[model samples]
Each structure stands twice: as structure tokens, then as C-alpha cells.
Target: MAIKLLSQFLVILVVLVSLFVNNLVLASEQYKDPIVIGMSAAFTGASKNLGLELYHGSMAYINKINQSGGINGHPLVIKAYDDGYNPLPAIENTVNLVEEDEVTVLFDYVGDPTVTKILPLLKKYEAKNIMLFFPFTGAQSMRQVPYNQYVVNLRASYREETAGLVDHLLGIGHKRIAVFYQIDAYGRSGWDGVRKALEKYGLDIVAETTYRRGTEYNSSFNPQVQILQEADPDAIISIGNYQACAGFIRDARDANWDIPIANVSLVGSESLLKLLLETGRKTQRDYTQNLINSEILPSYEDLSLPAVKEYRNAINSYRGKSPITKENYTESGYNYVSFEGFLNAKLMVEILKRWTDFSDQDQLHEIVDHLNDFDLGIGVSLQFKHPEHQGLHQVYYTTVSNNKFVPLKDWRKWSK
Candidate 1:
């Protein structure tokens, strides 16, 4: 009897121990490791607002997705570094993100110079399956051969934007177009776009001026304004940032040379408008007269679109909970840059869902290359057809009205 009791006790003990070990293994499998995405953007210096807003918008959706059990039970994480909108730091940040952080993907990089500089690194790190997704610039380098396989663009190119602007201006009988551009790859891209569009009509840029990167709003743009004024062009397209563009607008208005100025989506329109409004209020002058800004994303105020409504709701919920530092934070309310960032995150998640195995990075290129007609609630289907990695080609134009950017319904407002 004693021997039989001991045997029964040992059997129970073994069964209990087996159950405990099995539970531990199941728990390990249940709680998977996080999927990390890396970013290198301008969190400091002149383009700080754009960087911070983009981060905030991406996090808004990412945080929600994680809360609801992230993509395939793997939480999404972002490891970001501030490049200060410079190329060298961007390269360093890219290396750190890939080598040390070991991020699963790279997303939402800012500025043309920084992105163009970092493109070569993707080929170098091809063994790591590194891909640059949704960089902020519309420069052609990312859309063309060599880098096209490694990069994907979520916004319209500068060529599309400039062509639309030139076509509209010409439709309204404004042909003599001048260009104010930053002397860099980005500026040259826009300059090239305008030149090509005008070439189709046998027209040419009547005047052109260049500004160095990081030119501040407090800096004098009187020289640039003088050059544009002397050209006597009917309209001017500016390929530069908010501070420099706003400063030029202020000076140009102060000089009373308001012959319709247009800017591409690269300029942070909200920030530019705010700066001009503040200056105008102080100086008792209207600096926003005859101003046009081309946008890659639809207007945020459009409530009818599912994407806009979702974006507003997401931003409202994510505000005050963003991880941005105090110095980098801004009251970015319904901004285009942030909206684009939000869409970037949304589409990434969608793609991951369709991918059979997210852990297999080697298969990413094949998946993305084959992805087609995926909708992000943006009223447009996104397709990543190979040899054409650019997802969106639609460009919208806006002008200042009642202290806000409204759609350009009538081109006659700026007719010469």
C-alpha cells in the first residue's frame, strides 16, 4: 500500500511539472517581439515642425494599432533620430538605425539632400533587406532607376506638382513664370520640372533666383525679390522652405510686387502661413496676397473623405500623448505633412497584413513589388507596380483665403 501511494504521488507531480513548462512555452510564443521601424528626420533646426508633425501623425496611428494588437501580434515600434535636416547626420542616423537598432523598416525621412545622400546606403545594406519607405521629398532621384527598387514614394513628384502649377497659370493667361529656388538637388528638381513643362509650350523661365538652404524668415530676401521684380514675370514659383519662402513673400509684399507667387508641397504650408500672418499682423500689411501652394495630399478640411475624417479623429485622440520633446513640439493642427505621415503608417500596416511572413525580410521586395490596388481610405487605390514605385500621382493646388488654404477653384483670381 505504501509503495502504491508513492507511485501515485510521483505521477501527479510529473503531470503538474509538465503543465507548468508547457504554459511557459505557450506564453513565450503568445507574446511576440516588437517590429521596429526607424526614422531619420529634422527634429531640430529649421525644419523641426515638419519632422515633429510627421512623427506625431505616424505615432497616432501606430499607437492605436499596437493597443489593438499590432500587425500579426507584433507591436510596432519607432526608433527615431534627429538629423537636423543635414545629410551627414542623416547618414550616421541611418547606419545606427540599421546596425545598432536593427529596425525592421525605415520610414518618413525628410528633405531631398538627406534622402538622396542616404539612398546609397540601402544598396550597401541590401543584405539586411533595408528599404526606404515614404520619404518626404518629391525629388526624381528616388523615383528613377538604381534607387527605385530600394525606395518607395507616397507623394506626388515635384515634376507633377510644377507641371500642374504651370498648366493652371498658363490656362489663366499668365505665361512669364520666374522661379525662386534653393541651390540644391531639391531646387534643381523643381526648376527642372518648371523648365520641362514650359518647354512643351516653347516658353522658358523669365527669371530665376537661388537661396541657400536654412535661410531664415528674419533674413533679408530683398535681393531675391529685386531679381524677380526686374524679370517682370506674371507669376513666380518658389522651391524652398517655409522660413525663406515666407520671408520672400513678406519682402515682396513690402515692395508691392505681388505678381502671384506659388510654392510646391515641400514648403510646410501651415507653418509658412502662420509666419506670414504673424508678420502681417505686426507690420499691418497683407503678405498672403496672390499666394499659391501645391499640395500632394488632399485638404484636411474635407470632411467628406474617409481619410480626412479618420485623420482628424486620430489626431484629436493622439494629441497631448505624443512622445515629442518640448523643444520640438508645435501646435500642428491638421497639417499636410502630418497627414501624409499618417497615411504612410496606415499603408505600411495594410501591406504587412497582406504579406505572408513579416519576419522574412528578404521577401519584402517581392511583396511590395507585387502589391497592387490597395486602398488606404484615401479615396484612391495605391499600387506599387514594379519600375514605378511612386504610389500617388495626384497633386492639388491651394491659395490663401480668409487666413486659410482653400482649393484653387478659379484660376482667374491670379490672372495677369
Candidate 2:
């Protein structure tokens, strides 16, 4: 009887130890595979600036999270692919990220055309693409149906920026506003927004002009300048990127068209600033004295904010050099990249943690549908519901002084 009792106790002890080991293994498995977040952007070619900045920002945040032991103790892995600012390669990259790498989330890419190409694929897979931040510009199609379900815009929309511009000009008692915009989706969106906002003030656009994407005439404002001069508007609102805007500004100045110049967030880049300064120098010309730049994110030079300070430190630690350029780069400018990428990744992690199981796509959609009023402190807070996916409505106004953009007004949000 004694021998039998001892044998029974030993057997029970062995069973308890086995159970403990099994539990440990299960826990380890949970954290072993880092959650993969895929990114596709114009890492090369014409739009490389957009892609490079985004890549640096996303990587900086990934490093920060990993250093802190990751979200819920699980590491994050970013799988990045260069789409070269082209549609076909973008689709191919999306396929590889979803089918082969099995990424849990998708981050921002550069242009509307490229993103539009990949939207169907995302829908087909019902991809768990949690967030998309700062897609280069505020094209309305990006905020439209089916695509908006997965996108969270960080910058203020073209409509919001134009509204702010109109408000400022109206407050200063300037009536007749003129606009020069690209003839694509981005340009049309701004044009619509400006028209609607002006209508609110019982005003209207006196002159409106359109230009093609790669118009060489954009380099010298002689012809376009002649057109705007003929209109004789009090203020000019440009809705294109650096190359085009710079050309228009230079030519307008050379033509002696003196008026308050305002531009969209798309022109809010270091590269654009550098180009403008260079153009001014090369032509031995000075156009508008007070140039206004509306920004979607906080200025990189804002070192007073804790977030900005942290961002500077992160860039220094990770990249070993600052991301800001002497002509176009600001500490606050680089912040947009880090802030957006970091927040998107964090949101994805939070969603994953709340998920009881990752295998169920329906449950993932449910979680995303309820993600409203999420704040990332980049500039504007985000609120996403089932019917709306464009999370932000705020636009901040800034101006160029001594070749740096300075904030003009408090952040303004648009509704409806």
C-alpha cells in the first residue's frame, strides 16, 4: 500500500510539470511571430521624396515600439516595397505583401492613381488594412466609398485648406480670389472646395486656370502670368505641387502680379521650398513678399512640443543624422512622417490585441468600424465610424518667413 501511494504521487507530479511546460509554449508562440505591416510607396523615380520620408518615419516608430518591448509584448515587423510611383508595380507589391508576406496591416503609398489601382485587390482579399496616412495630397477619390473604409487621412483635405484660405482673405477684406490648379483629381478637388467655401462668404472666384501635370510652360510663368495678370485678382490660390507652383509663382512675380499667394498642403514640403528659393535666385527675381503655406501637420521646427522633441531624438538615434534639409526640411516636417506611421502601427496593434482571434476577417472589420475619436497628436484627432473613414477634418495655416513656414492660425476643422 505504501509503495502504491508513493508511485501515484510521482505520477501526479509529472502530469503537473507537463501542463506547466505546455502553457509556457503557448504563451511564447503568441509573441514569437512579429505582426507584419506592409508598406508600398514610390521609393524610387519622381516621387521618391514622398516615399523616402514615409519609409524613414515608419521605421523610426517601429524601432521605438520594439525598443519598448512592442505592443502587448509582441514585436512588429514592417515589410516595405517600392512601387516607383507607378500603378502596375504598386498592384504587384500589394499582391506580394498580402499573399506571400501575410502582412496584418497596410500603410500609406504616394499617389491616388497608385492607391486606386490597389483598392480592388484590398477589397477582394478583404485585407485587414487598418490605416493609411498622408497619401501625398488630398484627392477626393481617396476619401470616397469602399476605399475610405480602410483610409485615415492625416492632412487636411483640399476643401478644408481652401476654406481656410478663403476665410483668411475675407477677414483681410480681399474679395476677388483667383485659382490655378492641376487638371487632375487633386486640382479638381481643390477647385470644388474653393468654390463652395467662397459661396459661404457670398463671394466667388474671379479667375480660374488649369494646367497639365508636366506642363513645361509651368517652368516660366510668361504665358500663365499674362493670363493671371489679365484677370487682376486680389489673391491667388495655387493647388499643385512644387514644380508647378514654383513656376507659376516665379512667372507671376516677374509679370509684376503682386497679390497674396496661398497654396495647398501638397506644396508644403522642403523640396518645394528649396525649389522656390532657387527659382527666385536663378531668375534674379522676387515675386510675392508674404507667401502663405497651409500645412496638414505640425512644423518640424517646433521643438517646444514634447512630441517634436521626441521625434528629433528618434531621428537622430535611428538615422544618425537629421531628416531636415537646409532649404526644405524642418524638424516639424519630418514629424508628420513619424507621427502618422507610428500612430497607424499603434492602432493596428491595439486592434490586434482586442481581437480574440486574427484568423477571422469579419471580426477585424467590426473592430475597425468602431475605431472612432482616435488621437495620434500629429495635428488633428481622428474619428472613424462605419459610414465615414476620412478620420481628420482639421487644417492649420502657416506662412513662409525667412524661408521657414510659421503657423498663422489655430487648427480649424471642417464638418459635413
Candidate 3:
């Protein structure tokens, strides 16, 4: 009888211990696990500056929120992989993020080719009810249907950006536009926007030149630069990344081709300005007057608006001061990409909070369907109605001044 009782007590104690261990694991899985976001962008190679700016900006906001206690009891974490702005590596990073890391969302990928190549994966996941949110490129794919069903864009389209530039230049009576572009889908997209914009004015590009994609700014731009110099259009519209575009401008100036240079927002305004300043041929005034870079948001330094003020505070406060993670960022301070990244985080969190249920992708889609006419502070609003994937229709024009991007206040008044 004594042996029987002792055996019985041991069995009961074992059962209780197993139950406790299981409960502890369940609790850990539930409470300690954070909400993961994965990013695949060019963190190295020629496009490093662009990638870091966007990454830093998005992470800055995310870090701020998590420090304050996170979203609905879950912390926000970002995992990033450097794809060198290439497609093959992007595919690998994305697959791992989806299947292994199991991130809750994907955000702010730079480069049109990267986004274009990844759309099929985005669709594959969408079939499983997963969505890719707020990619960085304003490519037409993100703005078109079926694909747009899976993507939720936060900015104006490349077409809209280019049109704004053409209209403003036309307003000032500068035609005879020439174009220089990278030889890729990304470059082609910008070229097309320019073509369409010029078509509206019954005009055509005076000269068009191309450079092989993925080369650095220091690459031989002399051939293209010489071509443009010979044509000598009133203004040259450069549709490429900052380094290459900056190189073209630098080379053009070297050739004494002093006509105005125009660039779409993807040109990396801060990087381009930095290159010009470092080269020492152009002063702040020289750049602010002769060179123009169109923007989706006003100059980062323009803190007059309520949203701009908030952006300033967030990026300045959080920029590069945090513990390091899978991704690295520049402490070089706030600019267009980082500010845009901060805005991306804000927009994501806002839409996410309204999600009917976190796990229901269908519900998220429903929310996106009605996400139009949304207010995003700074007195700016968004319209995301169906058949129109672009949330923001307006683009801001900027020029470098005082070593920074200064809003052309006149352009805004005229842009309207």
C-alpha cells in the first residue's frame, strides 16, 4: 500500500510539471514574439545610399513606436537583406523572409526592376492571402490592377512625377527636353513617363542617350554627356539613380553644357547634391537654380507644415542612434528617402490599426478598398479608389539651396 501511494504521487507530479512547461512555451510564443517586417533593397553596391536612406527612415519610425511600447502589445521588428539592387539576390532574400522569417509585412523596396521582378512572388503569396505593402517605387505595376490588389502604394506614380516636371518646365517656357536613362525596366519606366508627358505638349525629346544599368556614377558618362552637349537642349531630363545622374550632371558641367538639368525623385536628391558640392564646381545657389529634382514630398528641411514638423522630430530623434540590427543606416541625417520612410511607417501603422483582424488578409484588402480619401496629416490627404492605385496625386518640386533641398514655393503655386 505504501509503495502504491508513492508511485501514484510521483505520476501526478510528473503530469503537473509537463503541463507547466507546455504552458510556459505557449505563453512565450504568444507574448514574446514580435511583429516582423522584412525588407529587401540595395544596401550595398551603387545604390547603397538610396537603400540606406529608405531603410533608415522606415526603421527610425518603427524603432520610435516600439520604444513607446509597440502596436497592440506586439513589438515591431524589421529584418533586412542587401540585394545590391539586383534581382537574383532579391528573390533569395524575399523567399527566406516569407518562408523562414515569416515577417508580417514587406515594405519600401527601392528600384523598379526589383519591384517588377518580385511581383509574381507577391501574387503567389496573395493567393495565400498575404499582401505586400507600400513598395518604394512608383512604378506602373504597383498602380495597375490585379497587381494593385496585392500592393498598397503610398506615393504618386512616376508618370505623375514626370508630368509634374514637364508641366512646370512648360510653365517656364523651357522645351527641347533631352533624356538620359539607365538601360533597364526602371530606366525605361522613367523614359516612358517623359515620353508621355512630352507627347501631351506635342513635343519630343531632342536627344536621348543610355548607359548600361548597375554602373557607378564614376563610370564613363562622357559619351552620353557629349551627345547631350551637342544637342544642347533647353533642359535635360535625367532618369536614373543619383550616382549616375549626378555623374551625368557633373560631366555635362565639365563639358560646359550649362543648360538646366531636371530629374525625377528617384535620383536621390541628397546624394546628387552631395556629389555636386563635393566636386566644388557648383555652389548651393548654382544647384538651387540650375538643377531641379521633383519630389513626392516637400523639401525635407521645410518644417512649416504639421506633418513636416512631425517628420523632423521623428527622424532627427531616432536617426542612427539605436542599437544595430540586420540592416545598417547612415547617421548622415534626414533627407527625402528617410523622411519618405518615416511617412511609410506612419501610413502602415495607421492602416494596420484599422485592420478588422490581424490575421485576416481579406479584411485588410477590404480596408484597402476603402482606404481612399484618407488624411495623412500636414493637411495632405490620400485617395486610393479602385482602378487608381496611387494614394497621393500631388508631387512637390525641389531644388538644392544652402546645401539642402529647398522647396520652390513658386512651383507649388504654379503646380496647382
Candidate 4:
């Protein structure tokens, strides 16, 4: 009877121990699942090209990291959703990513309207490890928020790029300048930048114009062109995306207005180049010659740089069957996505390495807050602080010549 009782007690003990072990295994599995990074982009519709480039670049980096054993032995997974460059869908996608998917970070989508709708949700959820990288929109509202705790802007701010363009024009002795900007926050930011930069030279804009997005302003450009021509500005600065800028350029040229034309970094893409070329308008040639493109990454065509070579090798190795074609291989857009995503992933990995256990959210936030002036490689560096969330503050200038973008100057730190 004593032996039988001992045997029953041992069995009960084994069962309890087994249950506890099983629960621990389950918890570990839940934690080990790929650290989810959510992406909001325009996968469909007009801005699909931008989305495709961003997705490919980000996925390429993710694949490279996973092949090398991932972030602290846990794979990084990207959960992407198409917002079609619309605000409502973007907001809905943000809610789903945070509440349902429980993503660790959020990749940016294009357009100010869409991002504006999602900002409050990010704050409301207190998504601890969440950060937005390489946002397509450069609105001041996105970058200048009072307590943007979890946001990290990758691109040079609209104001910075605009000032750079204006300074370059001023250096060339272009005194009279005309401005054409989109009628939105993004456009307004560039307008303000131009205004401030010109103030330094004691010069003011000779003529200024605005256009609404998704509207046909090609015909209406006649009066605006006449006004700019009458003003006889030595240069014209465009602060909008491809469509409106293209129309403005074409109309200006058709009206026999020949002057140096400069545009924001948003206009520095293959789509914009293709649109200009496809129109076969004389303005395309003039615009291409005079257009000054600004970039936030090293030029892919410059093989002298180690980072560019690595990026080239990555694209060649990973994209085997569907290789990036010569016609579509500018690397500006791809470099932006990869550079931002890789840096974010690297920062996360660094944080993980510093922690022996990943159970504390406060520690994670503190580490991220303390991350400042960390160099990633090939001139890409990040600086994050408690008050300032804009991680990157550098921009590179380049120009498209002979169907290739050539670097004009070395990387320069941007000033407010």
C-alpha cells in the first residue's frame, strides 16, 4: 500500500511538471515568431510604382538579414497593406497593424493625407518599438510634431531640400525665381523653405503659382506661364510631384518660356523621367537639362562607393529571374527604401544584443531614445534624441545626365 501511494504521487508530480513545461514552450514560440514590421503603401492604383520599389527594396534587405541569421536569431517579417494613397484606408490599415497584427514597427506610405490620418493612432496605441522610416511625404506637420516619440523620418525634410535647391540656383546667379507648388501641406512646406532661403539673399519670389492634385491644369497653365514670362524669372522652382510638375514644365516650354527649372526630391524618380520622355515634348529636353535632382542616398551608378557596390550585388543576387532592367535601374528609390529599412533593422538588432531578456518595454524605449549618431556604413548615419525624432539629417545632390544620375556633391548635413 505504501509503494502504491508513492507511485500515484510521482505520477501527479510528472503531469504537473509536464503542463508547466508545455506552457513555457508555447510562450517561447509566441515570442520567437518573426518580429513583424508593418508596411503601408500604394500597392495598387497610380502610385503603385513607388510602392513596388519600396516593397522590393525593403524585402531585399529583410531577405539579406534573414540569410545572415536575422535579428538576434529571430526572423524579420514584413506585413504589407495597400492604402492606394488614400487617407481612410491608411488609417484603417494602421489600426489593423497595431491592434490585430501587433506589428513591432511601421514603414511609411506615400502622401501627407494618408500619414496624417494614421499619426494619432500610433500615439493612441503607445506602440513601444514602432518607428516610421522613409516616409514619402515631406510635410512639416509630420516632422515638427511636439512629442513625436515613435517617429523617425529618413528623408531630408522638405524645407531642407528646398533650401538646397534655392541655394544652388542662387549660386548660379539666378536672381528672379518663380515657384509652382502643389496645394497641400507638402507643397506649402517647400514654399516656406524657398521663401526662407531667398530671404537670406534679400530677394523675394517674382511669381508664385499653385495647383491642386488629381486636377488637369495643363490648359490653365497658359495664364500662369504668361505671368512668369512677364516676370522674366531666371529660374522656376517646382514643389510638387510628377504630374503637376510635368504639366507645368510642358506648358511653360510650349509658351516659349525658357529658363532654368528645378524640382524637389520627390520628382527624382524613374516614373517622372519616363513621363517626361513619353510626352515627346520639347519641354522634356529643356527640363531634363535644367532639372536639378536631390537624393538622400548615394548614387547607384557610382561604383566607386562600397555601399553602392554592395547594393548592386544584393540586387543582382536576390532578383535572379526578374532582374532589374537597365532602363529601370536608377537606384534612387530602391536605395531610399533599403537604406531606411536596413538601418531600422540594425538598430533593433543592436537593442536586442544589449538586452539579455526582451520582456521590458521601458528598457526598449529607453535604448531607442538613447540611440544617437550611430553610423551604419557608407556615409549613412542616424541621430535620435528625446526631443528630436528625425533620425537622418543629410542629403546628397545629383543630376540625371545621359540617362544616368551623376552625383554632384558629397553628402552634406542639412540645416533648418
Candidate 5:
């Protein structure tokens, strides 16, 4: 009788232990699932420079976080599609990301035309309500009120960029400024910013010309170049991507027109410099000396700040190493886009860390929409109150010196 009772007790104990082990395995499997993020940007075309930089920069942060046991034990993963900086593919990519890929969030879209194209799709799938965070473009189309509240912007708007560049030019007494823009919403947005800034000073653009948006990065800007050169403005502001903008600069320079050329942030500064050095006739310094571009973030080289130091260290550590997207790692490593991408990812991790239910769209929005006066580690603050989701309101100006982008000290609007 005693042996039979002991056997029954042992059987009960075995069943309980089995249940505990099975639950542990199930829990582990649950935690193994990753957070999926979707992205669409120019990866193979004229705009690959910034597009790839943005990918690596943001991915560095995400990869680090995953290595450190990701937000709430779920790794962050990106599902990206290349739009080649065009509108049609961007629409398809956007829809597929939200529907087929079923990503929890969208991020780091590259161009104005792309983002503008995706807006209606987001509305069509409004029920999905997947939030788009920190697009690379500073175009105002998605940042305006009555704009898709689902969209979030990490960088300063083109309006702010053009305003700062205009302010700098005006302060330095360069009044006759010509606008060289791509014939698209992106270019027109910069044009609008310049116009608004000039209005304050009781002035307007001296001349304006445009190239097609999808022009080959290294293609001819001769028609636009000849027209702008004929205007003979004291200065010209190039508001296209690096490829076309560089083409415009090179062609204009070849025509013996050497006006001080300034560009908006979307031009991809370092890439622009590379083009000038590789394909242009003059010394790199000669072309870059008179060139200026607006920067949305402080220089990544300013390692005195803890955030900048962290960014540099992160990029250094992750350089040429990403399991997800190996192509992002370039021999020519960091730039403004990378720095901003890191910032975007840092903010993204912070946003995701605060919430756990990735399955619930409403849960994500709660954390995002209510981000009030949150102090970003860079000693600046970000907020996402309703009808306005643009995070950074400040802008900085930079110019190339010795093959690097250094601060244009007098042109920065934000205090250090």
C-alpha cells in the first residue's frame, strides 16, 4: 500500500514539472518575435547616398538595442523597399509595407515626392494607423496641420532650413539670390521657404530655374544652368538632391559661373562634395569654399556632448557591420543623414521602450501622441502634440572645408 501511494505522488510531481517546462518554452517563443519596421527610400538610384546612410545610421541604434536585449524582449527589425527617389514605387512600397509586410511602424522615408505620395495611402489604410516616424525629408506637406497626424518628423523643416540660409545670406549682404530647384514638390517647398524668408526682408528671388526630379544624378543641368547663369544673381541656392544639384553646380561652374552656391539639407552634403571632387574641373576647395548647406542636427564631430560622443562611438562600433542590411556599411562612413538617423532611432527606441503591446496600434499612438516636452539627450527637447508632429524646430548651417562639413558658426539659429 505504501509503495503504490509513493508511485502516485511521483507521477503527480512529474506532471507539474512538465507543465512548468512547457510554459517556459512557450514564453521564450513569445519573446523571440521581433518588432517589424517598414521603410521605402532611394537605394539604387540618384539618391542612394543619403538613403543608404539613413539606413545604416538608424540600424546601428536598432542593432545595438537588439544586442542588448531589445525593447521588452522583442528585437527591432526593418523591412525596407527601394523607391529610387520616385513616387510610384514609393506608393507600392508603402501599401505593401502596411498590408503584406504588416509592419508595426514606418520609418526614414527619403524624399519629398515619396512621402507626399505615401500620405493618401496611409489615409486609405487609416484603420491600420501605423505611425510613420522621422522621414528624411523636411518638406512641409506632411508636417502641416490637418496633415496626417500619424506622421512624425524628426528633422527641421525645409522652411526652417531655407529661412536660416536666407538669413545668413541676407546678413552677409548677399541679396540677389537665385533659386535652382528640381521641378517637384520637394524643390517647390524649398522655394516657398526662401520666398517666405525673403518677404521678411522685403525681397524676392532674383531668378529661378528647375531640372526634372528624376534626372540622372550626374546628368545634364545645362538648360537650367544656362538660364540661371544668365540671371547672374550674386548667389544661387541649389535645392535638389546631391546628384542633380551637383550636376547643376558642376555645369554652372564649367560655364564659368562661380556664384556662392547654397543648398538645403536634402542635397546630401558629403555626397555632393564627393561628386564635385570626382567629376568637376576645379580643386575641391575651390568648388566647396563658396558652398553652404543647412544642417538639421549639430555636427557629429562635436564629441564634447555626450550624445554626439555616443553617436560617434555607435557609428564607429557598427561601421561595416550590419547583419540586416550589409550594403548600408560604406567605406566613407558617417554624415548628417547618419547622425540624424541615429537620433531618429534613439528616439524610436525610447518611444518603443515605453510601450509593450506592439500588436495594438492604439497603444503605440498613446505613447507617441503624448510625448510632451521630452528631453532628448542632446540637451534639446522634443514634443508631439496634436496637429503638429514635427520634433526639432531648430536648424544649423554648414559649409565644406577640407573635405568635411564644418559648422557655419554665425548661421546657426539654435543655441549650443
Candidate 6:
């Protein structure tokens, strides 16, 4: 009887050992596979610069990691699809990313309308624990109650940006403000923010005008400019993409309407400047004058910030080298949109470093929530907790100086 019991015990031990070895082998294989992050942004529309630069900026850091041996020996890759800044394509691309590509996470999405339309997918995949990381827009829809849990934001919200713009304008003694925005959720988000900010002072927007989304640089914004001119606002806050905003600015300046015009960061400052400068040269007008842009990130020209230095180094070292960079994609030196994208990649990697197991998506929120008081060397402390998903709160303002966007130091210069 003792001999028979010993043999049975040995058989059970062998079975246990076999199971353990097989599990170990499976885990090893999974770890060796590349971790893919999916992205959907405009690559062919008027907002293409935002998508392209954002992708390039992200890939600069990501490529640096991959070259040195990626996170825990697993290469990080982004499978991107162009949505052309439209809602329908964004939905299609997102669906394909979740259903077909099955990427580990979503990162660096662009545009408010696109991001807003895709928020419902997070709920649909709630069981899968899918979350979007650091999309480009600052719209409030994703930051609000129901959808906030599904997304982690790296930048300040549109509300915060508009508030800062209003505060400075008010501080400089400009009370009668106006707004020019795209006719979409994004524009409405900024408009709402401006309205709320002005309401605190018992004032409201002096006038408002709207332009359709995807309006090109060549499209005439004279009508919108005419409407705002009639209202004779002290300042105008524009909430739209680079193309539409540039068109409006060109027309406003061409019409000799020199009222202070402020744009939210989503305007893609570099792209707007490029268009306006080109038109200004042709028309012999300085369209960049009296222009101000609210930014969520510091100026790339500021080499004092550690993050900015790192960004310039990474961009110079990795431009046109990222695996996803297309042959046709040209580098536009350094710009805010891409700089924000570089920061987005840096933050994502920081979040990922805290995770040992990528298989369980449920752990993402817990991991992010625990990242408290973390510093990214960006001259500010970043925090993420259960209720608050946004990591950064600082808003910056910039205006064109010497053909580049620099930090706004004196609000009195623009005071009407």
C-alpha cells in the first residue's frame, strides 16, 4: 500500500510540473510579442499637420525606446489609421482598431468631434478595460462624469484654456469679448467655456460667428469677419482648427480689423502661422499681428525646461526615422502640436513602466490612479487619481514674435 501511494504522488507531481512549465512558456511568448498602441487622427485633411506632427513627435520617443530595447524587452508599436478629421472615419478606424487590430491601448487621438464620437466605444468595451490615452483635443465631453473614467488626459481642458484667455484679457481691461468657432462639438466646447468664464464677471460674449468644420485655408471667411467686425468686440476668441482659424485671421487682418484675436491650442499654431505668413507675403499684410494662442504646453524654444531639451534632442535624433513615418511626411522643424505629442508619448511610457502585466487591461486605471505627484521634468508636477483623470492643469499663452510663437509675457501689449 505504501509503494502504491508513493507512485500516485509522483504522478501528481509530474502533472503539476508540466502545467507550470507550459504556463511559463506561454507567458514568455506573450512577453516577447510587441505591444501595439492604436491611433486614429487626420492625415490627409486641413488638420493633417496636427495628425502628422503628433505622430512624428510620439514616434521620436517611441523609436528611441525601441532602439535601446523597448519596455521590458517588448517593442511598442502604433497602428495608425487616418480619419481625415471627420467623425465617420474616426468611428470606422476605432472600430477596426478595437475589433480587428486588438491593440493594447488607444493613444494620441486628434480632434474633439472625432474623440467625442468614439467615447461610446469605451463603454461598449468596458469589460475589456479599454482606455484612450492623451488625445489632442481639450473638449469637456471626455473630461465630464460618464466618460471621464474611460480616458486619461495629459493636457488642460478647453474650459481651463478659455478661462486663462478670458482672465488675462479682463486683467488687461478688455471686457467686451467675442468668439469665433467651428460649427461642431469642439467649437461649442470652447464657446461654452468662454461664456462661463465671462459670466463670472457678469458679462457675456459681445458677438459670435461660426464656420463649418474642414474649411480650407483658401475658403473665404470674409462673412464671419464682417459679422464680428460689426459687433466691434474688444477681443475675439477663436475655437477651430489651423485652416479655418487661419482663414478667419487672414480675412480679419485683411479687412483691417486689428482687434485682439486669441486662439485655443488646438489651432495648430505652426500650421496657422505658415498659412498666414504665406498669405501675408502675397498681400503685404502682417496677419500674425495681434494674434495670441493659448497653449497647454510650454514653448519648444524654451531650452531651460528639461522636457523641452529632451524633446528637441529626440526630435532631431529621430525625425523621419519612426517606423510609422510615411515617405511623404516632411518635418516642419519643431512645433507645439508635435511637442505635445512627444509629451504624450513620454507620459504613456511612464504609465506603462508601472505595469508588469499587459494582459490584464483592468489594471490600467488602478495603475494610473496610483501615479501621484509624478514629475516629468516639464516644470510642473503631474498627478492622476480616481476622480481626476487629467494629469496637467497649467495653461500657457503665446503670441507670434519674430515668426515664432513665444510665451506671452506682457498682457498689456495686447490690451485694447
* lDDT (Cα atoms) of all candidates against the true structure: 0.87, 0.67, 0.78, 0.66, 0.81, 0.88
Tens-place lDDT per residue, model 6, 156-226, is: 99999999999999998899999999999999999999999999999999999999998898999999998
Candidate 2 residue-wise lDDT, 1-416, digit = tens: 99999999999999999999999998896667687777887655544556666656666766787888776677877677877666788899888888899877676676665776776886677545444534555766667787776565545577778888888787776788889987766677788989999999788888888776545323565776677778888788888756677778777777666677888876535555666677678777654355777766676677766556666667666652222221332333453545544445555556667766667766766766665655454544566654445556777677666765677653221111
Q: Best to worst by TM-score, what's the order?
A: 1, 6, 5, 3, 4, 2
What does candidate 4's lDDT look like per residue over 214-257, in tens digits? 44323356766776787778888887766667677777766666
Worst 10 residues of 3 by lDDT: 321-330
Supply every candidate's count of residue pairs whose N, Cα or C atoms clash at under 3 angstroms.
0, 7, 0, 0, 0, 0
- Candidate 3 yields a Cα-based lDDT of 0.78
Q: Write the per-residue lDDT of candidate 1 for residues 33-105, one digit (tens) a residue.
A: 9888899998878777778888888887888898898888888888889898889999999999999999877
Say which prediction, candidate 4 or candidate 5, comes out ahead on TM-score.
5
Model 5, runs deviating above 4 Å? 1-23, 26-30, 280-285, 319-328, 358-365, 410-416
Better model by lDDT: candidate 3 vs candidate 5: 5
Candidate 3 residue pairs that clash: none
lDDT for each residue of candidate 3 in 180-297, tens digit (9 for 90 to 100) = 9988888889889999999998998888999876778667689998887788677878888888988888777776677778888888888888877777653422433478888887
- Give per-residue lDDT, candidate 2, residue 274: 64
Residue pairs clashing, model 4: none
> What ranges in model 4 sit over 4 Å off?
1-31, 127-130, 215-227, 281-287, 320-361, 409-416
Candidate 5 local lDDT, 190-302, one digit each (tens): 99999999999999998999888768655777898888777778788888988888888877777777667899888988888887877644453345556788888877777
Lowest summed lDDT across 10 adjacent residues in model 5 is found at: 320-329
Using TM-score as the measure, the top candidate is: 1
In angstroms, give how far residue 187 of model 2 lies from its true place: 2.0
